[model samples]
Target: MQNKAIDFKRQVNIKLADTKLQDALSRLQTRFVEGRSAVISEIHHLEDTRTAAAAIRDCVLNDLDSWLQKFEQQAIAHGAIVHWAETATDANRIVTEIAAQHNVLTAVKSKSMVSEECGLNDALEHAGIKVMETDLGEYILQLAHEAPSHIVAPVVHKNKEEISDLFAEKHQMSRKTGIAELCLEAREILRPAFLNADMGISGANFLIAETGSVLIVTNEGNGRLVTTLPRVHVAITGIEKVVPTLEDVTTLLRLLPRSATGQSITNYVSVLTGNKDAKAHDGPEHFHIILLDNGRSSLIGGEMQEMLRCIRCGACMNHCPVYQNIGGHAYGWVYPGPMGSILTPLLSGLKSSPDLPNASTFCGACAAVCPVKIPLPDLLRNLRTRQMALGLKSRQEVLMLKVWGWLTLHPRIYALATKIGVRILAMMGGERHLLHTLPGATGWTDGRDFPAPSGKTFREMYRKKSTK
Candidate 1:
């Protein structure tokens, strides 16, 4: 498959030309932005709550090892098995081993981005374990054999008709079925999967070190069922998900759902504290928490350490203009948008995704909406610097930047160039006042209308005003 960083430019062009994808992404992102703004506006202490949340995350990250050990000890005390994996391969191996030990035939999973990052479903399937996605959005994606487009709404890119068709082809449902009917059909199908699942796997929104609890927030009841109904429950999450205390979890929870989906809280928030009583027969008899490092631990005490504070609320992506235009699939990875731009290159290596850092408009909307206030634009810039230092940038881009730098150092030449360029553009614009294309800048004008220049540079305008 053509992936991001490798075929990003082509993918972006494809997404931009796809009117349907553009329309769907625009509506979904607009709704999410408005919803987040409306709910956050009602919180009088929004800043304080976010600040507390950031501080709590920072504390855990600063001493992450200690907190993780504490969580492991407490979880063990509560009759849970805690496993640590330093890499994605290691994590997949651990889960497969556990499934093998239990001879797990089928496993049910809730929406866990970490598991997606690890490619857990394919791993389990390769090991002869049948995996079922229980979250409605994830279930839809699973059926379609697609990756999630958005963090909060996984199948946001899919329209109802498309989904109806998918269900019809995959589940023998009528193609003419409405959305409600489709949901009902999905529910009916997933209910049986939950009951027959040999094990349940989920992602943790937050790991409470004090209580050894795995906190999960979901709109569907699938999260609860996945954790409670199976013979075994497994949670795979990043080491950064750990927090200092329950109070901290409460503070972060206030900001997470509001920033993510514009709700004060998700419909269901389940806290699994190591199978309180395995013999009770009401919940899972076996509880396991897998902590995956996957390059995150290396970020500590580094320039990008603030990235560790992210709670994965996805507010950054919702408000990003670039993300709205190109959509997530163009990003070519498990994570997308601003967070993905930074994390993908950091995790996958700068050479693997040289274009990601340059994907943003650097408008700062992402940093502004971020719950923990990660400087996303700055992070992107940092990645760009890293890319340049490693000589990963194309020679043409480097030469262009060198020429631009030279021009900027000579003000007179720069002004002269700008004035000439504007007059040329203005002439090209003619009556339409729009340039259909620009020489050597086709990428900028390919899927957008470039506004005509005013025939005068900013310097000329300022000079005339000063003379007056």
Candidate 2:
């Protein structure tokens, strides 16, 4: 993960200068933000709903032990096998073992970020099983050998023309294919995979503790097929996804789509409690649920606990100034934006991604748009504090900050330094209000000019006015 942070700085430089990439990000981010704003306006008491949703999440997280135990008992009663994974390795091994035991040659999967987090496809393939992604965006990314740029809109970074080229090269389709035609071709390819797959795996939007059910919402009907058509169905999700009741799920469902894709409701919402009952013969006969902890449990009583309240709506990224500039891939991880900034360090360790928390401008746009109202800016600041306390920052940076702090505490020396600094910069600026070059800050001056200070200091002017 530390390697990823080191790469992030390099990637951001390239991405910022790519005009085509910037254009695509601007258009798509605007669309999502506008759609969400419009839908939110139409809903009555949306803020109240957000508050209630936050409270419910807080309740479940506070007493997670009780909720998880009850959920496990109820799920077992419903004929679903429950498995607990304390780490990503455990999760991948569990899913692979299930495939191996059932003699599953092929597995079809819906959009599951948890699977990405655990690297499930690679694990399954290593065990000699074929895994096919059924969601259109996910399938496109899988074929291209790329990770998702956005949470809900996995391939948002890609344009239709690029996709047409990919399909033509990989699927032997004509390069002049249209958007609708590409989708149809993908459907034709995936339909057979779905029918032949011996195992189906998915991620849950919310897990119901009362009913022992997993709720999946998607625009495409692929989620329904993945959970129902195969002989064995498996759901892998974070333990934080569990809710106490269906009514709590209803409140969250209303916020999920509206905040995620700006829809009143998703096209498909599949609720699977167990596999098949006595009357049902078509659905998966064997059902399994894998609850993954993967560093989430350690955050329960910590400052980052608020991060667990995220619903994965992508609203924070959509509104983030930094994310809008560099895009998600530049973050170099499964999650991105303000949520990713906090989560990456917390889950991976503050020393791993020391620069992530500092990536923000602290504008707080992410906090404003977050459905669960996680104070993202505060959390990010806390990460920075942790990093500094751990001495993770470079020695040069720490020294500069310490010098600045000492000067700030000494009023007379600070005033004298500011006066001298203003005169020097003003002399350098000459006729211009901006400095095109600055020592030790080439990164800031390389792309844009820095404002030059005025010739007169505020303290001098204040003294002159008082004497008059």
Candidate 3:
């Protein structure tokens, strides 16, 4: 597999320079931020619910094996087939096997990060099955041949004009302006795909073990169509998505929308029990639930287990300074933002994505706003420590950290080194008060301006204050 992190950064840099993309990003930020803030302000009990939700997740993670088995039993009893996948490859193989057995020619997909993780579309395509993404954001990205830029809003990186152009080229339609027109254009094309698709795949927002229901919350109706319209429905989700009951799911639901896009509830929250029963009018004949482990089993007893509590709200990404600047693709995986920083390395391994865990500013925004109260910043720090222990950090960075560690053990040298570093930066910048180019500071200055450090060190200031 290619290193998506590197490519994501390169793509972001290119996108950031484009005026249209910048405008679209700015508008998207304003819309989501304000909307979410308003929703949060309206809900006085949101924080309390978040606490409850966190506790629920804590309990689930603690007894994951039991909960998973219970979930499987309940789902199977309801006429759903539950398949366990220990790895991404296993998950893909399971989905492919099902499709092949059904003689599926085309599959319609709702937005599912688990599917993205398994590279499901690629696998299906390689197997000679056409897969179409039905979500508006995902559909745009599919047309553009790009990965999702946001967990919820996958095509947040593309501007209206770019989307218009992409649609025009792909479908041979005339370019149009305005959101409604663009949406209509997309609807015109995707409606047929939904009706004609052989199989439908989706990701569950929450899976209730008590009732054997898979809950899909969406602003658009695509998820419902995807799950019910096709002959076969496959729901792929992580093992951590399991909850004990609808009441537990309700607690999460209360916090999820407010923290995500700030809605009271998303427009659509469809609870699917199983395949279409004799009494049902419209629904899939076969319902397959693929529970993907993909390194989550190893994280169960570790400090990073808290990461699995994430509700995929995208609140963290919306509030994330790095995500707001570079967008989701930069994380180089299906998940992005503070959650992604921890998850990408854990799922993909630190060696495959050495830069991911270190991509954080550790601002605590993700943790503060998390609906399930996941300690994202702390988990990120833990991942960084693990990465360092594995010797995945750059040689220069490792040597610098070693020298710094040595200095810290010896206070006199630490003070001396700090003073010297300040003086050197001050001399290099002169009166500009900015170092445009510095050996170690290039990354900082690449996208944003970096201020030069003041000549006076904190130690020097502290010493003078004590003397005075």
> What do the candidate models score in CA lDDT, each in turn?
0.89, 0.89, 0.85
What range of 10 consecutive residues in model 2 has the weakest lDDT sum? Answer: 1-10
Question: Which residue ranges in model 1 land beyond 4 Å of their true spot?
Answer: 1-3, 276-279, 431-433
Predicted model with the maximum TM-score: 2
lDDT of 2 by residue, 357-460 (tens): 99899999999988898999999998888888988988989998999999999999999998998999888887877899999878889889988888779999
Candidate 2 global CA lDDT score: 0.89
In candidate 2, clashing pairs total: 0
Better by TM-score, candidate 2 or 1? 2
lDDT of 3 by residue, 1-468 (tens): 234764555666776676766666676679887788888867667678778999999999999999989889999999999999998889999999999989899999999988888888888899999999999999888888888878878888787778778888898878887889999988888999999999999999888889788999988899999998999999999999999988898888888887777788999999999888888889999999999998888888887888888888999888888777777766777888888877777877777777777777888888888888988888888888887888888899989899878899999888888899899988888798888878875877886666888898998999899999
Where model 2 places Cα greater than 4 Å from the true spot, the runs are 1-3, 461-468
Quality of model 1 by C-alpha lDDT: 0.89
Q: Which digits, one per residue and each the tens of the lDDT, describe model 1 over residues 1-468?
A: 123566787889888888889889878766899899889977778778777888898899999989999999999989889999999889999999999888799999999999988899999999999999988888989989999888778898888888888888998766756778888898899899999999999999999999899999988899999998988899999999999788889889889999999999999988889774734768888899999999998899999999989999889999999998888888888788999898888877777777789999999999999999888999999988888788999899999999999999999899889989999999999898998999998977876779999899898899999999
Q: All candidates' TM-scores? A: 0.96, 0.97, 0.93
